[model samples]
Target: MANTIYFDEAGYTGNHLMDPDQRFFAYGSVVTSDEEAKEFVESLIRRYNIQNGELKGGKLVSHHKGRKAIDEILREFHGRLLVTVSDKKYTLACKLFEYIFEPSISDINSLFYGVGFHRFIANILYMEFMARGAGAEQIFDEFQDLMRRPDDGKLGALFSASKHPDNSPVITQIREFAQYRAADIKEEVESLAESSVGKWVLDVTNSSLHSLLAHWGTKYDVITAICDNSKPLQESGEFFKIMVGNEQRLKGGFAGNEHPMTFNLSGPLEFRDSKTCHGIQLADAVAGAAVHVLGGGTDDHAKRWRELLPEMSILNILPDKDELDLRLGTARRNVVLLNELHARAKNGQDLIEGMPLLIARLTHRLNLPPIPRPVG
Candidate 1:
């Protein structure tokens, strides 16, 4: 029996920084056999009177009765949830520009950037961290202070100490963050002759897609992918082709290059209306619950979903402030970004505009940031 993954994302506002009310874009899936998905949908349509419009997390928030209906369906639906949500702030995408280019309150084109930026930063960090290993997990203060004095010959020593080699392009790539120290850094990045912020953003997205394809292709036998009709990667046949190639550039993340596998998909991924597909309907709820927890929600529903995630499926990609010295699991992704952030700060460089709260967060850390302490 072939397995299918019904995919949906919640709180996707183009770019996380673009949405004032929300700051995350979650890519979630409900995995089951093809026959199981169909049967569940049939049951949902008959049982909940679910219309063939569109099932959405926003709608599910107030649809407690609808939620109850979904819980009932899933008890017999037989599927597991798989999801990845990008916390844009921690993911290290530049959001400094949003401050300058804030669209009018009524501007319908406000959230145009989407989650591409978040993925871009995430994939970059994952790849770079893997190449450097323990070397990548530099003390934040050391890199932060080093960036302030780029002319110091210690740069050569630091590069020499890195496992990736001093002359490798990775050095240049990692150093770019702290290279700018004066003037309008936001405009500077936007006008960079080498790369526009847009190019960097797209590059990050492509890298992330490449890494994700690697992750998915190896982990599951995804026969059919029923994604939302509106997601950016929903109908991306060409995008997938270019990204999921057998190039040496793809692998990375916490797990490293051990499982550099290709796609085992049976056919082209399809997008469907969640309202019609009970799988996506439920996927949205799970994604919504995950986001709720990420955003510090403390409601009864949030508590319920928190209890639902199996430890294996609950991947925490963010860094634990207490354990910055150790590099393991998903925290490797954060280590890459934090190192770059510190590098940039030391060099007196400011990140590009539109970074959501990252600009403030970094500023606090670079200036006199608090070291996170465990409460007794």
Candidate 2:
């Protein structure tokens, strides 16, 4: 039998990523049999005397009884829940990298992408932009505008923000690349805007769905993804279908080496109304509980709820604050690495021959012991 993955989301605020009220967006999924899902819902209604005949995580975690219900649900479905939370402002930073520093524009895109230069740069940008305040906002605002209507003015403004005096060396380097290769970046944006693909980058739901599907694809060769009806999911139905049909394994790579283990998905992605589907309701509760705790829930119960997650849930927080390290120590180290890679790429040097040197620099920054030279 094919595995079923039920999906739902919390903290969705559309393209207004920097909304102060809802700073985080989350996607949640629950994997269980029909009987299990039905029983879980019924059990919650009976155990908690739920009168609404539905359970929404956002509403439940606000009080005591509801929190207990969520706790029990976690215990009941251990290891079968997954949730991905993204810092909205940080997501914009990632979007900036996606469009501004697009790797696919060049032959070496794959190399940089494989090694997670995309992510490191995004992280660096997120931290810097958060510190620079208005400058970062200008870039995000311009980028969002460009997404809506591809205009030269918006593109120029976005690049201009990158040159903020407070921006680290990495940001300055990227700004230089964007200006020098303005045509290529602009063309990429125009193509995306024309295709309406730009929206997906900022849609946490879309990214989360991709992530959840990839996770399940590793365990189940065939999956039946059932998600709560969502605008992004509805719009991307055809895309999701094609993604699974290709049976593609979304893997990561570094230094020309690809990870063998990945989620190979070949299944159908379906959407259902939460009112009718117990699975979707369960997914809502799971997503809600996650957002509650991760979004600064400081109560005693919230702490307890967090403790239950390590065993049963996979909570992925995009560009965690720790990774961004306010002190800029980590970010500065990443800048050095990016500067080295950029130098090589700019000079048309052979990256394959230079991989070891790059790897050494990265390891040394992390304070790892050096690898011994191979005997000739």
What TM-score does candidate 1 reach? 0.52
C-alpha lDDT of all candidate models, in order: 0.46, 0.69
How many residue pairs in model 1 have overlapping backbones? 20
TM-score (C-alpha) between model 2 and the true structure: 0.79
lDDT of 1 by residue, 98-161 (tens): 2212211114111212212233333444344435444343412233223323344343343334
In model 1, what is the error at residue 101, expressed in angstroms?
23
lDDT of 2: 0.69
**What TM-score do all the candidates reach, one by one?**
0.52, 0.79
Alpha-carbon shift of residue 166 in model 1 (angstroms): 36
CA RMSD of each candidate after superposition:
15.5, 5.1
